[model samples]
Target chain A: MLKIEGVSKLFNPGTVDEKIALLNANLHMKQGDFVTVIGSNGAGKSTLMNIISGVMKPDAGNIYIEGTEVSQLSEYSRSKWIGRVFQDPMAGTAPRMTIEENLAIAYKRGKPRGFSFGVNSKNRKVFREELSRLGIGLENRMTAKVGLLSGGERQALSLLMATFTRPQILLLDEHTAALDPARAELVTTLTENIVRELNLTTLMVTHNMEQAIRLGNRLIMMDKGKIILQVDEAQKQGLTVERLLGEFERISGKKMADDRVVLG
Target chain B: MLVSLVGAVELGLLYALMALGVYITFRILDFPDLTVDGSFTTGAAIGTVMTIAGSPPWLAVIFAFFGGAVAGTLTGLLHTKGKVNGLLSGIIMMIALYSINLRILGKPNVPLRGEANIFDGASVLTIGLILAVVAKIGLDLFFKTNLGLSLRATGDNSRMIRSFGANTDGTIIMGVALSNALVACSGALIAHSQNAANNSMGIGMIVIGLASVIIGEAIFGAKTIFRATLAVVLGAIIYRVIYALALRVEWLDAQDMKLITAVIIVGALVIPTIRRAIKSKSIAKKRTEEVLSSMGQTSGGGS
Candidate 1:
């Protein structure tokens, strides 16, 4: 469903504070592949996601989504095939907009927006039904400003929005990291349910090792701008946190130092 | 007093158009566009010049809107394409418009003492009311459209909207252009009603427009776009009424209007913060009472 070839990105090149974000990164995913990504801080995980989403162009790379090369497309253009949920709860939705209005925008994704009214009675009914599916009673608050929603509710709404138009790829960048444990669990469950039901090709970047291991068909570990380890379905079926840590130590020759990863 | 009130309402309605324009850029787009200060003059100058050249008053006003829209587009280009700072781009346009407005008029001012204007046959208040209502209704409808929602979303969160496949840069440009068009239309109407267009007439227009928007939102609330626009119009009228009343003071000169406008804007801006502070303070007091009462109840139960 997605392909990345020879991708490289350098931040502040030629500057004293230069850092290599991505280096010759290569990744591929089959249609409907649910892949979970795990890495420490500065592991180029976000850079990889950003490159795929066209938020920033790789210095040298070709990105193809559903067999179409979109490396040269602008972020908004590339968004036609990509749905993204950001790390910040506040980043995924417009705070001042209402639930139905937000859904209307998501519904128009990858489609031409013209003089037609964004939300009519018909769409409002659809949105209410969809919101009701989340089981959060958000259908009653279709006109409530999204800003008034809790972090968990907003993230869940964002998940619904990302899948509303059924993009070629869905990118989740620590989407539930800001929420409390219970809320995080709710969002994670919602994410799994939505992806599974739609059979969406999804790439979820997570700091939680258990989440990375427990969800998704495959798991990949990234470090120092490269995918250092990948666990296929066979290996992932028996994967454990201690074994993964041992594998990381054996491969990278360094202890897993990220506290969040360790705690998870 | 009655005549002053009537005049205030008339002028208020005229300025309400400009206030709505200001609301688009300031509140909707989250863009601090100073272009209105210049575009207002540009519209007035164009309208007067076109009218002097024997064009119909309505056509002249329409031309004025387009003229201002073009200026606004330039500002948008400077900010978006040229990668200039938004504030700096607006300032550049405002400075450039001074020369453009002077050239258009061929002088510092143009008097329409005997020329045909839209208000020549109609009462100024009636025409102003009609224009204001039309602009409000048009804006309310536009905001309900898909493009309009995208525009509002762009203002609310550019990155988020862009990820939804909306062209944010284009939306910003269109928004800024539309806003200035409205401002220019207001200026054209004012020029016709006042019987003259002066180069200096646009000075401090941004402040007045902002004042109207802030005052309107504070008093009328902005739960919806329609209500927000209505608030802006009412705010403009109230501002004009206050101006007229202030002029009635023996010590205040007509020239002090600008200072009074600044003061009104400051008051409007501060009112919200004051309200918030008072609300928080009352909440804190209520919490203290609750805590003390709970402690007293627990102590009494133990005793």
Candidate 2:
């Protein structure tokens, strides 16, 4: 359902601080494929996600969602086929807006937004039912500002918002990184349930090795702007953190020194 | 005193339109648009000129709104398309508007020369109240629409809204344009009431608008958009009343009005912080009492 071909991105091409964020990156995913990506700092994990989401265009190749090339599309235009959850809980939802208002916005994603009233009785009922599904009692406070919600609640709401329109692809950039342990677990469970229930084609970037291995049908390791390793579902069944570290050392010729990846 | 109070109410209602415009940019869009200082004058200039040119009063006022909207759109374009900073973009448009307003008026000021204006058919208070209520209701209705939700979201979180497939640039343009349009309308109304449009009439307009919004939100609270807009209107009236009362002092002169305006704004801005501090201190005192009472109960039980 998604194809990325030979994407390259060079930041500050000629300056002293020039860095090749992505080089000839290539990936393809089948429909309903949930893939987890893991990498250390500056491994171009976010750059790849940005390119796929059209937040930043790749300097050299084409990206196709359902066989239609979208490399030239603007971020807002490309968003018709893509849903994203950012790392910061505050980044994925508008704080001052009410829960129902935020959902109304997500419900109309990729659709024409015209003169219709935003939150009518019908949609308000729909939003109430949907919020109840979160099991967080948010339905009772539909008019409450999202800023009043906790980080985990906001992230869960963001996930629901992203999947409400059922985009062609969902990009999650370390979405649970900001929450406390219990909240993170709650969000992680919600993410799994929502992705499974919707059969969504998702690409999740994570710093946690166990989560990287435990979730997703496919796993990929990235380093220095390249996809260094890939493991299918069969291979991932027996994958261990130690083995993954060994593989990283063997291929990149450097120790995996990022404590976040190891400790997380 | 009674006549001054009535005059204050009329002036306050007229400036309420401008205050509402400021509320959109400053409170809703989180944009510090300096364009108000110029666009307010732009409305006055355009409306006054049109009135002098034999157009109907209502038509002239409507034209002034469109004129201000266009000026606001220019600022939005300069900011979004030209990649200029928001403050710089507004400043640039404001400076350009000075020359544009001059061209429209053909001079620094223009007198109506007893030309029939909107207030001629109605009392100033009645007309001002009607127009202000219409603008407020119109704004309230517009904000309930889908486009308005997107605009509010754009101000709250542009990146998130973009990810949801909304064009933030368009929303920004629309918001800034709408804000200035209302401001200019207020300017036109003021010009009609005063019987003249001066180039310097818009000076300190942003400050006054900000003061009204701050005072309104501080006194009345901004629980909802309706309340917020209502508070702004009330704040404008209260501000005018205070100005009128200050003017009654024998030592005060007309030139000191700007200083008074500044002081009023400062006082309004500090009120919230002061309230918070006082509440926190009271809470601390209560907490100490609770702790001491609990300790005394435990000691009595042990004895």
Candidate 3:
């Protein structure tokens, strides 16, 4: 479960280029709620995600994870309850480090890291089993540097690493956008399966309209720093791409102007 | 000739600790730390001052490591907490250390004459060898620990490590502190070995350390932490041996030692770039030739 109350973020405040990224945004999710977010660029989608993950703070607002106020916590401290897969696959994994070593870091997420050996027999077996589950044959290349893997493989690995520890909340920032269509589809399915297996409460920001509509129990759309629409699970099933754009036009009084929204 | 050869090896063994320190910051953390220039003298100053006050030689060297750690921690704090640039923090620390070292020594120079230096008894070369190997083994083991993995990850991809619940600022500080500690340890030994510590002994220390690290990686390859550390050790020895050999040139003056070091580092860095460029050029020419021949064949077919 997660809660955001009256969160507002302003960038370059008091400057000539002053911009409002998020304005009094409110979002809530119960246990195991999967919510997909979509918006135009600069629509404060990422700003909202960043606030929740503690990467950036809202100028005015409070965030609570499971009733614990965490607006004041640092990113690393808040990471105990939050797992993130960034848009850039390279951003989620160290290239020079081996696949197993990267997994070791993820396994100890939310736990105190210490002087213990990182890649011992016990953890190596766990990592191998988990990699095998990805069905990418990564189980056999535990010692290979992550840099050698393709973007799709890295994204798959990143998804596995983020959810393996079973964090309280999952944040995906267009995690599959960079992949080819087939790879994106593969990662998309994996994301759904892993979230279901772990029963994780997740907020996925996506550019693809169909993906936003197809996945998750609930959906929200943002425009001009505000959550303009929220559709529940039952309503989402009847919705199609044309109707979604119609809803966007009805709410914002403008067509989906961002080429990426229509293109995606 | 044999005596100078043995002496070069001895010097190499002592300075290898310094190179290992440089390796941690340079290769491991990807931080170009200038604290080496000051920390080396900080170690020598502390060791000499303590030895003058009647402490055992080895104890002085141990304290010197602590002194270097403190100095390095200062730079880390300046960079991480103070929000200063990485290079500037190192420069600031290196400059501040000069005054601090002078204060510790209470003079510009200190002599270890008639003192029971750690390398005084039995074979100095054996002492150097034991000290260097012990330090190398200790470093290699440290690199395998969980904390060490996080440290390496911080250098490689700090954002990824932070998302996995790590404070990169803490790891960077720890790395810099450990690096300078080893540098000071080497300085302590060198001061005792040569019977004196001078104010200018630390000049160009970073270059020498970088040279050693580069030479080692070039020869041994750095595919693994263990191999990399060994390369650093061997590189230090090789650099010193080459320095000795360069000095034997009849026309080369003693004053040219620094110049020789500078040239070696320049050559080491530039030669690789040059060779890679030439290799790429040859490949380009071959490709161009093939393209021209294909065009010729097409025209011949048309004719």
lDDT tens per residue, model 3, B61-160: 9999999999989989999899999899999999999998889988898898987788767577898899889999988888767888889999999889
Full-model lDDT for every candidate: 0.93, 0.92, 0.92
Clashing pairs in 3: none
Interface RMSD of 3: 0.8
- Give the higher-TM-score candidate: 1 or 3: 1
Clashing pairs in model 2, backbone N/Cα/C closer than 3 A: none
Runs of candidate 2 exceeding 4 Å displacement: A262-264, B288-303
Q: What is the TM-score of chain A alone in each candidate?
A: 0.98, 0.98, 0.98
Writing each residue's lDDT as its tens digit, candidate 2 over A196-231 gives 988999999999898988889999999989998988
| CAPRI classification of candidate 2 | high
lDDT per residue for candidate 1 within B19-124, as digits (tens), equals: 9999999999999999999999999999999999999999999999999999999999999899999999999999999999999999997999899998988899
Instruction: List, residue by residue over A23-94, the lDDT tens digit for candidate 1.
Output: 888889998989999887889999999999989998998998888999989999999999999989899898
The lDDT ranking, best first, is 1, 2, 3
* Interface RMS for model 1: 0.6
Where is model 3 more than 4 Å wrong at Cα?
Answer: A262-264, B279-303
Error of 1 at B216 (Å): 1.0
